[model samples]
Target: MTYLANPTRYSDMTYRRCGRSGLQLPALSLGLWHNFGGVDTFENYRAILHTAFDQGVTHLDLANNYGPPPGSAEENFGTILKKDFLPYRDELIISTKAGYTMWPGPYGDWGSKKYLVASLDQSLKRMGLEYVDIFYHHRPDPNTPLEETMAALDLIVRQGKALYVGISNYKAEETAQASAILKQLGTPCVIHQPKYSMFERWVEGGLLDTLEKEGIGCIPFSPLAQGLLTNKYLQGVPEDSRAAKPHGFLKTAMITPEKLEQIQQLNALAQERRQSLAQMALSWILKDPRVTSVLVGASRPAQLLDSLECLKNTNFSAEELEKIETILK
Candidate 1:
């Protein structure tokens, strides 16, 4: 079947500028962290991608270590890009990251010029991209000098392997240092990806302030707190849910009684807002002016479509915010 994009795709969704960079990203960018691997159904993810773009989700995020076997997400994304998204390439913001163990031996992992450069080359080949819209160092490496990793990012940009550079999972202090180095290198760290949600508020302590000060846009991952913020577990864990899965990051044990209560309270609030628990959760993150985007993962096209509804109502009253804070605490 031919894959013609929605003509009015830009009508409903919103785009925010990434830091001080000329680039802007969709409020809800799709993340290929799970369920787009070689082990998953290709049609399923392809359909999700289609639905995402149709709703103005122009940014697609990926990591070199996304798949269970590693590198398969990029390969699958490559196939879909060639098949359905070749023409719409100019309208998309494609980004990927490195800085994890990809292969055997020391050179295959961490933040080094050799590892980052080689990993990105492999990533480009897998995605069939000449250059990604943004390339990120997936995490901070305590063992490696920060300058080396930042320099590697600058080098990739100079070589035209990436249009912009970013850092992920880095703390506030680390982010400030990295951003300073990138600024000196003339690359200017444009974005910061952090694990933040109602459940995980570490970024609120300092990261968000640092990013704003450094002129780096913030895009938070795990905005739903690994599905806890969603309505799926309000009743209890479902057999088919991520928490029920033995192999995934979300474990059954993490769904304690207290967590369920918080989920239920939040669900009640979501109902008042005429939104789903997931939608409200995402909206909570988007309510922060510092957040440029929120990266979400979807297992199905319907799920992705459901997530897009968050954009419809992201505002919360002062009372609502106080209630949410009380419940979270």
Candidate 2:
């Protein structure tokens, strides 16, 4: 079926301006970090992508080293792009990153002018894209001169290979420095994608203030803390959950009994509010004006839809906020 043929699909998920940029992204963006990889089943990947788009999730996040085989996720996602999402390319915000270990040798990774630029070009080819909506420096490279990395980003934008540029996993001070460099280069940094959730409030250390002061939008990834904030672990680790998956990002040790107790209390609060833990986790992050979007990864279409519903109950009363903070404390 054509992506637009489903009339009910467009009724859900809201779009918000990415900071002050002209681009508007779905409130809940889908990420291909976990599933949609080499080991993941294709049927599951296709269903999640199709269902997400039909439900108005127009933004998809990808990185160079996402899959177990490094580039397999982009290759797999590209297949879906060519099949179902090709026709709606204009309506989508497709982003890919480079800066992590991809390939081998000196030029294989990091933030050198050589590495960042070349990785993006390879990413464009792998995803069969003429240009990506946004290209990100996957992480900060202290070894690489900030000037060199910023120059490469400026060149990519000037060449029309990417419409906008963003940074991920950068601290407040580092982001402020990069934002200053990009601002001077005429390619002002537009967004910052960070890992934020109730359990991961490390960004509050100053990152949000720095981005806001710099006019850079913030999109938080893992708003569910790799599914830790969800109900999946409230009882025990499910057999097929990320915590149980062999060599997954979420390790079994992370689901300690103490952590489970925290999740249980949080889930109780969520239940009282008539929302799921996943939704509450997402809503907690989105409560900040600095957060422009929540980058969520889903293994199933139902999970994607359920997360999107978080926006519907985004408002949290002062008491609720206080209670959450106390629990988190």
Candidate 3:
């Protein structure tokens, strides 16, 4: 069956400007980090993408090393784009990153110009895109000079491989340096992707302040803290959950008793707000105006719909905020 997008897809979602850039990203962007790989069903993956787009998710985030086997997510997304997203290309913002281990040998990873340039080329080929909307250096490389990495990003933009450039997993000092270099290169770093959630507040210490001063947008990954912030683990680990999976990042050992207790309290707070724990978690991130968007990953379309509900009630009163802080503390 041919897929048709909803006519009112843009009605409910809010778009925020990405830093000082002219680009405006959807408040909630869909990420293909988990279940869109080759091991997953094509029909299910395609359904999630279609459902997200139809509900006004214009930004789709991917990484060159997203798949278990590596590069499979981009390949699968490429096929789906050719099939369903081609007509709406201009209306969507597609992004992919590099700087992680992708292939054998020294040139395959890190922030060197050789690796970043090659990785993005491969990503574009996989996604069948002339140029990605945003291309990011996946992480900082201690060995590589910051100048070289920023120069590579600037060159990619000049070469038309990407419209905007960003950096991920970089600390405050590194971000400030990279942003300065990119600014000098005339391709100001437009966004920063970090891991931020109620359970993870590393960004609050300095990254958020640096981004605001540098004029870079902030899009937090792991906003659900690898499903720890959601209601899924409140009753203990389910056999089907990520924590139960042997090879996944969220291990069973990480789910401590104390963590579960905190989750229970937060879940109660979510219930009072008439929202799911996941929704409240996401809403808490969106409560900050500095947050350009929250990147969400899902194994199914229903999960994506639940996350979209975060948009409906983002407001939090003084008491709710204080209680949430107390629980998190």
Candidate 4:
């Protein structure tokens, strides 16, 4: 059966400007970093995608190395796109990244012009799209010249392969430098994707301030701290949990007793706010105007809906904020 998107999808969700750019993204965007890979069930993947779109999540984030097999996520997403989202292509903001160990050779990795251009070409082919809404250098290449990387992004836009360009996992100073170079090339850096959550507040130091000054949008990944901020682990790590999976990013050591104690306190506060711990964590990130969107990955449609509920009560009283800070401290 062909899936039909809900007509009133745009009614409830909020959209914010991407920094100073004219483009706007939904407050919540779907990320295909997990569960949409080739290893996962296609039926579940399709359901999650449909649910997210029906609820007005217009952006779908991807990367070259997202899947267990590196590029399998893009391939899986491509299959779904051709099947379901082809008609709604104009309504979506699809983005992907490169800059990790995608292949064995030196040209296959890093921030070289050769690598970025080739990676995006392969990405476009896999996704069955002529162009992506945004293409990102997955991380800063310490060895590559900033000019080389930024110039590659500029070339991509000029070649009509990507509408915009961005950087991920870059610090405040690197972002500033990259933004300047892209501006000089007449292709501004429109957004920055970083790891941010109550458990990971590194961006709060100076990166957010830098982005504000540079007029770049911020979209935080891991806003729920890889499910640590959720109630799923309060009792104990499940056998099927990411932490329990030996090869997954979330390790058992990360869920320390101290972390669980903090999560318990935070969960209590979330209950007072009438929101789940996951919802509150997302809402907390959006409390800042600097955040253009929160990138969330969901294994199921219900999980996506639960995260969406954060938008219902984004308000945080000074006391609540202080209490959260106290708990975090």
Candidate 5:
């Protein structure tokens, strides 16, 4: 059955505008970085996509090299788009990115006119998309001139392949400078996808301040710290978690004794609030006004639903904040 026919199933999720723009994305958007890769079974992929849409996750984030084989995730998601999400295209905020190593050779990756344009073309073809809602430069290309990268992004927008443009993993000054260039080119940057969580506060140092100053939206990936903020590692490393994946970003060494103790302390605070550690971690990020949405990855429908439950109690009293800060220290 087509997924759009049951759109009402997701009516409960709140939608927020993308940085003063007219585009309204779901508060919690689904990302296809890990579980939806090519190596995963088709049944699990289909179920996650179906469950996400039904759970009010209208936005899906992807990149050119999301698969173990690179570009396979886009291909897999493209199949789902053709099979399930095509009819409801207008209701979805599908985004794909370029800027990482995708192909061999010098011009294969990074933010150059040659690479960005070619990457988007390949990404669109892979995803079977005529136009993606947002196109992001996956990361900053220090080697490439800012003008070249910005111009490439500008051209992508002008070519009508993307409605808006975004950047990821950019520092404060770089984001500010890129926003300036994008605006000058008549294609204003709309969002910044950064990594933020209780365990990751790098953005809080200055990146967020710059985003607020520039009127750009922020969507934080790894909001659960690659599942560390979740209960999956409470006792010890679980056999089926991201830590178990051979090439996983979250390593087993990350579960140091000190980190485990910190988690245990934070878990007590979560229990006090009558919420799971996962929900608390998500809510902690949402408390910041600059945060437009949280990008999350899920292996199952139940996990997605459980994360969304963070909305039920997002308010963090002064005392709660104090308790969390004390624990972090």
Candidate 6:
């Protein structure tokens, strides 16, 4: 059977402008970081993608080194794109990042004109994309001069390989500098992807203010705190949970007894708000005007649907905010 996207996909989901740019992303964007890798089931990720698009999640975030083998995620996405999403390409916002260790030797990693240019070329080939909606520098390269990196991104845009450019994992000062450089080169930094959630609040320190000042949109990854902020951990770690896995970003030791207690407390508050803990976690982030959208990863379609439910109730009361702060404390 052929896959046809739902005609009513945009009827309910929310879209926010990316900074001052004309691009508006769904409130919840799908990230192909973990589950869509070469190691995961194709049918599962395919269903996840279908469900995401059916609900107006037009933004698909990716990185060159996302897969366990590196580059496999893009290959898989390219296959899916060719099969299911080709006709709707104009409506989608596909993004990919570089700046991490991708291949080998000197030119394989970091932020250099040669590396970024080559990496995006490889990424374009893998994803079957003539140009990505957004291309990003995955992280700040201490050894690479900021001018070289920002110029490379500008060049990529001029070459028509990327419509917009952004930076990820960059601090306030770095972002300000990068934004300035890109602006001088006649391409504004449209967005900034950062590690942000209730548990991870480093962005609030200074990054958020800088992004706002620079008029760059903010899309936070790990908004669920690597699944810790969800209800699954409130009772105890599930046998199938990320904490139970021997390998992965979330370690078992990180889910301490104290952390479990906090999860329980947060879940209780979520219940009062008539939302799942995951919803509250996402809603907490979306409540801010500075956050254009949030990057959410789901292993299954149902999980993606549950995460999107956060859209229904993004408002937070003063008491609720204070209580959450106390619980986090």
TM-score of model 4 relative to the true fold? 0.99
RMSD of each: 0.8, 1.5, 0.7, 0.7, 1.2, 0.8
Flag regions of model 4 displaced more than 4 Å: none
Deviation in Å, model 1, residue 114 alpha carbon = 0.6
Candidate 5 residue lDDT tens string, 1-329: 65554547566888777886777788889999987877888878888888888877889999999986799999999998899888878878999999899999988988889999999899999999889999999999989999889999899889999999999999999999999999999999999999899989999899999999898999999988888898888898989888987888999988998898889888889999999999999889888888889998888778888998998888899999998988888
Q: Per-residue CA lDDT of candidate 4, range 1-329, in tens? A: 89899999999999999999999999999999999876899899899999999999999999999886789999999999999999999999999999999988789999999999999999999999999999999999989999999999999999999999999999999999999999999999999999999999999999999999999999999999889999999987899888998887799998888889999999999999999999999999999999999999999999999999999999999999999999999
Per-candidate clash tally = 0, 0, 0, 0, 0, 0
* C-alpha lDDT values of all predictions: 0.94, 0.87, 0.95, 0.95, 0.89, 0.95
Stretch of 10 with least lDDT, candidate 1: 62-71
| RMSD value for candidate 6 | 0.8
- TM-score pick, better of 3 and 5: 3
Clashing pairs in model 6, backbone N/Cα/C closer than 3 A: none
lDDT of candidate 5 vs native?
0.89
How high is each candidate's TM-score?
0.99, 0.96, 0.99, 0.99, 0.97, 0.98
Which structure is stronger by lDDT: 1 or 4? 4
How well is each residue in 1-329 modelled by candidate 6, as lDDT tens digits?
Answer: 57899999999999999999998999999999999888999999999999999999999999999987799999999999999999999999999999899998999999999999999999999999999999999999999999999999999999999999999999999999999999999999999999999999999999999999999999999999999998778888899999899877898889989999999999999999999999999999999999999999999999999999999999999999999999999
Cα deviation at 28, candidate 4, in Å, is 0.4
- Stretches of model 3 off by over 4 angstroms after superposition: none
Residue-level error in angstroms, candidate 6, position 266: 0.3
Tens-digit per-residue lDDT, 1-329, candidate 1 = 99999999999999998887898999999999999998999899999999999999999999999886699999999999999999999999999999889999998898999999999999999999999999999999989999999999999999999999999999999999999999999999999999999999999999999999988999999999998898789899999999998888899999999999999999999999999999999999999989999999999999998999889999999999999999988
Which ranges of candidate 6 are over 4 A from the true structure? none
lDDT of 4 at 280: 96
The TM-score of candidate 1 is 0.99
